[model samples]
Target: MVFKTPLLDKPAPGWKQDLPGPNESPSIEPYPPVLSNPPNHVDNVYLELARATVRTRGVGVWLTFLMFSLAIVALLSLIAYILKEGTMPPPIPGIALLMGFIAALWGGVFIWRMDVDPPRDEPIRFNRFRRKVYVYRFHHHGLRPFSRTAWGVRAEVYDWDNLRAEACSVYGPMGSGGLIETVTLAVVKPGTHQVIDRFHFAHEIQQGEMYWAMAQLFMQQGPQALPAFPRPPRDWNNEDVSFNLARRLAPKVQWPAEIDLESRTAS
Candidate 1:
């Protein structure tokens, strides 16, 4: 004999639902997309420099205070011990104390300048490799008091493709300026994300898939060949891509090369 299970009726439209327990997890929504400026941020030095400006401010202050305090304490202790233990006469103890004070003061001042109110904030640009990372910076205000202020960092590996950048207004007590930041790309092949090398591209690769992640194609095979037939130039049609941006600049980026983005896009 076969045993049949009884059919259960569906719950009413407005019936109160019973939850499994407090141990159950609640549903979560996906994170929002991050907006960025400067699409090619993977190797831009200027973007990293801006980040350093904010980071260094806090570190510099703390280091300056600590070094200065240590210098004062060490100098005073040295002078007191020398006067108490050494053969120096009681009448000339003030000279020993003065010497110790000077030494301590000098060290404190030197550390203060090096740690707080650093000299410059320069521009930089660089490339980041798969196995290794690279960084570059420009000399800011060449010979001024605050010159050559720059810093850089790199990780073992980053996704070169699918990289994005964004621009925003940087605000400080003084005023505001344009600021840009970059996000490194990542991928999980095995259990975790790992860095790879150039040699991995030894097989068949297509135009779209080959180097979309890379900042610029090296073109090892030389320049690509175009069709033999020449095409006539188009009539005055579309507006220039940088027109709006250029008009606002006091001194625009006037490069000698033709700004033929439209033609490049079409081809």
Candidate 2:
């Protein structure tokens, strides 16, 4: 005997109303294409320097102050201890005071150097048609304590073809340490192999990939080749193809024998 099981006739609660039916098409608007800055007349790839956060600067200042305070307190305590003990050694009389003085001097010098060599915000631009890289740096000028009363911008240009070699060095605690990796890209002089410029990228691996792609594009493309920014492949970071390409192109860079060294040096 054949028997048919009874089917439930009730509709699932709100299922038909909430979701599109098999024959119905959902009403969805397609996302608009993201618009980027139109390629310049000569197609340039521009990169801006990363800026430090106010919190980061605040922490740095606090750390510096703490270090200075600790140094001062230690020096004062040592002086007081020596005075109370009334101990004098023939080999090094007033040794504690001498050490404290040296420590204070070292700390003062460190703080002075840090203040003089403050971090700069610089942006770099690469021109494919002109085969030049431009770096823009801003300078501040003022009198006495008011050091930042006025500002000026300076531009430095370097030849793309003169880039003899390029290298990316990765350093940081890998594995389980959880420290972020730091990458440095250095451009070297062709024959001398001396580093002319170095670019540092922190945490962001995509920036390093983009730079390596640019280097490869510069090497392989002809002078008249249309200027285009190299797009990173899907597996750019996974396989480290950018790093490999940079290594391969480094040895192939060559400068014309007749090129004037002085003019190159000036740039």
Candidate 3:
């Protein structure tokens, strides 16, 4: 038997090729959107605010030192003037000088401590759910999680939770000359008293997206009251691509909600 070729076996016809319209571009599908740069004025203002916040911390430190130094100089001058006058500087005046000395000493201690003290501790609780495979780090690492970068900070996702990877923002510097970025997911239930990873401060991946994702995730499960985290302006928008992706990927079984009431109260 002779072997036949598939394409050559088709019937031949008088062919008229249809072409694209004169002005129409080739029909490639449009690409999905990534995050857009915030509008000019809005972004400028936000950057300005962020820059100001970083600078303000430094300014506060210097201000405290200056005040303490001024207090010491004033106290010494008062003592010298009182001794020179040789009249005990009056009962009322001497008492005022004494008060000034006390204030100076206290102020100096406060200033020194502010610079040397450990970062203010916020109540944090840690838990491991779903074996070593799933661990969650949440709540009150104080300035560690929110105030600093979040690149490599330990984050948690329920095994059953869905992650909408594209919609999240990953921030900060990654190792070996690579930039750091974060992708976050939606959790069915919230956990509590999580110890924050301090080592990840400068390497944050989800500095901006976490607040928005958390808010929407909380809203999706019925209308019961939930504890509020700080609201960022971006949280106002509805239904991001990530939310849709997460809905598709989310685990079929919901995780039980866990509470940490004993560790601390919202300040």
Best by the lDDT measure: 2
Note the clash tally of each candidate. 11, 0, 14
After superposing candidate 1, which stretches have Cα over 4 Å from the reference? Answer: 1-54, 88-122, 125-267
Candidate 1 vs. true structure, TM-score: 0.25
**Residues 1-267, candidate 1, lDDT per residue (tens digit)?**
111321112211221221111112211211112111122122222112111222233343455466566667756666667778895445565566556566545554543444333322211122222221222121123223233343121222233332211111222354464332222112223332232221111011121121222223211111121111133322111324243221222122121233212112212
**lDDT winner between candidates 1 and 3:** 3
Once superposed on the true structure, which residue ranges of model 2 sit more than 4 Å away at CA? 1-56, 86-117, 136-156, 164-180, 191-202, 211-267
Q: How many Å off is the CA of 49 in candidate 3? A: 21
Q: For candidate 3, write residues 1-267 as lDDT tens digits.
A: 111321111211211111111122222221113222111111100110010001012233456667677777768768788688866677777778778776765665544333323221111121112111122232223223223332122223332222211221233364655543332222222232122221111112233233222222222331132222233323112324252332232222211243222111121
Every candidate's CA RMSD: 20.2, 21.5, 24.4
Two-way TM-score contest, 1 vs 3, winner: 3
lDDT score for candidate 2 against the true structure: 0.36
The model with the greatest TM-score is 2
The weakest ten consecutive residues by lDDT in model 2 span 13-22
TM-score of 2: 0.42
Candidates ranked, most accurate by lDDT first: 2, 3, 1
Q: TM per model? A: 0.25, 0.42, 0.29
